[model samples]
Target: MHIAAANREDDLQRLHEQITQTRLAILVTHNEQGLQATHLPVLLDPQQGAKGTLLGHLARANKQWQALAEGAEAMLVFAGADAYVSPGFYPSKLEEPRTVPTWNYVAVHAYGRAEVFHDAERLLDIVSRLSDRHEAGRATPWSVGDAPADYIASMLRAIVGFSLPIERLQGSRKLSQNRSAVDVEGVRAGLANSPDPLDNQLAALMRQP
Candidate 1:
């Protein structure tokens, strides 16, 4: 991603926080055939490596994993809040009459070398962690052990686990940072008042430094 200096996000903790908040990531890889993507619920192990490690799985039937055999690098994309920015939102636009509409959004990209672990024990551990991460927010959390042992084993066998130790992390928070203070406030107010929840989210992001 080509991130402008004003929109670049360099804080590691902030980037990881966004990763944790995102529900799913689009994992991208290049195979001998071509580029492929899979939407996956990935776990971030912040302490696992120099950067961090990603834990996720794909169904055994998924051919996307076959690309790993050729040692392909992987990229996981996490999308955040986004909204439409109307030129009318900027008071300066009224005077200049040259401004155009644009989209304001936030996204993170993680690059790494992926390793597949298509075994029972490792798969069990990965799935258990993933389950715990999601369940922690519930009033009554679920666990991998809640299911029948045989059933859990069968499910694990049907999926293949993988780990990507993130080598590089990039974050883009393209709010209206390039605009004037008055114009930025105008954009924020417009988005904050929008009926769309996502627009409110994008507006909320504008309040942060």
Candidate 2:
């Protein structure tokens, strides 16, 4: 990602939160065939400090998993929120028509080496963690153990479990950081007033000092 100086997020904790908050991420890889990507919901395991691993599963029929192996490098992208920033929103635009339109968004990039785990027990663990994390916030939480043993096992077989041990982490928070304070406020208000909840949430984030 081409993150401008004003938009860069260098704090590790901030970057980590962005990754953890996002449930879905795009996993990308490069090979002889060129670039390949897969969209998946992921769990970020922060046991290894900055070198955390991303856990997720791929359908057995998915060829993207086939291309990954132990130590295969991959990138995981976590998108926070985005909104269009009109030039009219910029306070400076009232003074002159010099500023161009832009976007306000945040994203985190994780680079890692993958190790595919096929063991039934490991699969069960991964699935359980994913389930628990997602259900933690729900009023009626569910669990992997709630279903029949055989049925859960059968379901697990239809997919493959893997972990990407992170090697590099980068983040960008382009929330009109390059704009003047007045323009920033304008963008925030524009996003906050949007119909999309995500845009509203993003605006709130941008409003943070």
Q: Report the lDDT tens digits of candidate 1 across residue range 108-162.
A: 9999888988889989998898899889989999999999999998998899888
TM-score of each: 0.96, 0.93
Residue 73 C-alpha lDDT in model 1? 92
User: Which segments of model 1 are wrong by more than 4 Å?
Assistant: none
Clashing pairs in model 1, backbone N/Cα/C closer than 3 A: none
**Model 2 residue 121 CA deviation in Å:** 1.0
Q: Write the per-residue lDDT of candidate 2 for residues 1-209, one digit (tens) a residue.
A: 88899888888778889999998899998776678898888888788645677889988887678668634578899999888788988878878888887878899999877888778888888889889988998888999999999999899898898878788888999888778888889888888888989889889998676
Candidate 1 lDDT (Cα, whole model)?
0.92
Which candidate number has the best TM-score? 1
RMSD of each: 1.2, 1.6
